[model samples]
Target: MHYCQSCETPVAMEPRNGHAVCPECGRADDVAAPGPLFVVTGASGSGKTAVLAGLARRLQGRCVTFDADLLMDAAGALSGSRPIDWPAFRDAWLAVAHGVAQSGMPTVLLGPFIPTHLQELPARRWIGDIHFIVLDCPDELRRARINARPPWRSRDIEEQVEFGQWLRRNIADRVDTSSELQKTPRRPSPHGSTAI
Candidate 1:
């Protein structure tokens, strides 16, 4: 198992190319708000979805959240047979998230966030504070979650094996997702005033 430089998650070394994509969270790592981005990246069973769901509830109005899949349709449009003007979609959404971040709001982006393909976000001009988060869990537990997924929903075991290894190697700051899945890693929220 090796860790991905971009996502920082342990994954298996085989079949590692066709899918550099993370099953837990996607390109939210590209967010560059200078402030905490309230990220949630991890392996499928790492409790990424569960943690984010809780985080969203915990931070209700203080955060503006978006799932990585929120732009999947638009991303797909970029390769449409007719090329459905996806550049416009990309620019639009990027601008929206950046705008929201700029509004002094603590924002959370949770989903299958991959960091490699997507460039770092919000252009140099949009700089602010930035922090990162990655959730973690034991391999057996991860496999169980994958298995619990509906017949059509879960990723193949082989694929998850590779990804699981990858995530283990990459993550440094992690919150283990056991039954308690302790909120042991409560991050300093990006909202509120900064000391001058």
Candidate 2:
């Protein structure tokens, strides 16, 4: 058994591509370093997925996009008061993000994430740079969007909306999506402006 240098967790010593790999985190000692990561965070109705889809199209061939929800196993959390298994979610997200970054492509991650979530990832040490952007939409507009997609739990929507408000007040980079709802999805500039 070997211990991962990054996570300090015991891992099976599996050799792959002439390097010892960590089974749990898929960390290889000899792999090329990863590229910078740009994380786009927003609440449920804040248009995170749409924004990321547009970004992926605009940055085609130069970047890859991943939805954090797909990396997480939230079934347990959904039935409880908490909505995520922070440790498990963090580990899974880091593994995939690190692997994608190692391929030399910038990664765009979309999810309901806060800055603190990024800090908990084990891959933080290896990542080159991280750019965080929070998508914002007005409460009324957000509620309308959520309502249109019926069958959603009221409590969940309220929680997400509250989080979105908190993000707008605290996060440095925020892009308002209220206007985007009226027009086509455009590329967002690095400085947090929606480009035409």
Candidate 3:
């Protein structure tokens, strides 16, 4: 069974115009194939950046790693307030991912992304197997971590902690980094299907 690169749903073996089309999203698998795209997402101060950095160091030159915030900042898509411009952020991110994929490298994207934010990405049609991994921590620990950062905003930290709790409850693959750090990042299997 082949999975849709866009929505990660299992598509029938039947091919359309030489490509397996995702029935749910109507995205052709070939067009959406950007190798393997792993999104490591979590709330603010969730240790995602640290985890990705460790993974990159372990992988040596095998993969490409990028932070979504830096990408957004470079594109001027992020603001200092609530309600982000998702469409613009998605576009800019996809452009960078596409470039990385075109270079024949797997991508590890670290960011603060809810499930819905990923589902609504316009460039999903051109993305390959998208794996989502959410890092979680206790509220107190998260608060402490956020507070340790310079120029921290209390409101933003509170919001992030709340969202982190919600994400730990809602997301399927969650790693609790409160006590121990994950030494290695695992590559997602090509098997199984899920609705976007």
Whole-model lDDT per candidate: 0.51, 0.67, 0.65
Q: Which of the numbered candidates is closest to the native, going by highest lDDT?
A: 2
Best by TM-score: 2
- Give lDDT: candidate 3, residue 2: 48
Q: What TM-score do all the candidates reach, one by one? A: 0.58, 0.70, 0.67
Task: Note the clash tally of each candidate.
Answer: 30, 0, 0
Whole-structure CA lDDT of model 2: 0.67
- By lDDT, is 1 or 2 better? 2
Error of model 2, residue 103, in angstroms: 1.3
Per-residue lDDT of model 2, residues 34-104, tens digit only: 46778888887778656665677898898888776553335344537765556666556656666786677
Worst window of 10 by summed lDDT in candidate 1: 187-196
Instruction: After superposing candidate 1 on the true structure, give the runs of residues whose Cα lies further than 4 Å from its correct spot.
Output: 1-36, 81-94, 114-127, 181-196
In the range 94-176, model 1's lDDT, one tens digit per residue, is 45555576566766765434343124432312423434456666777667666765554546665665675675677556676
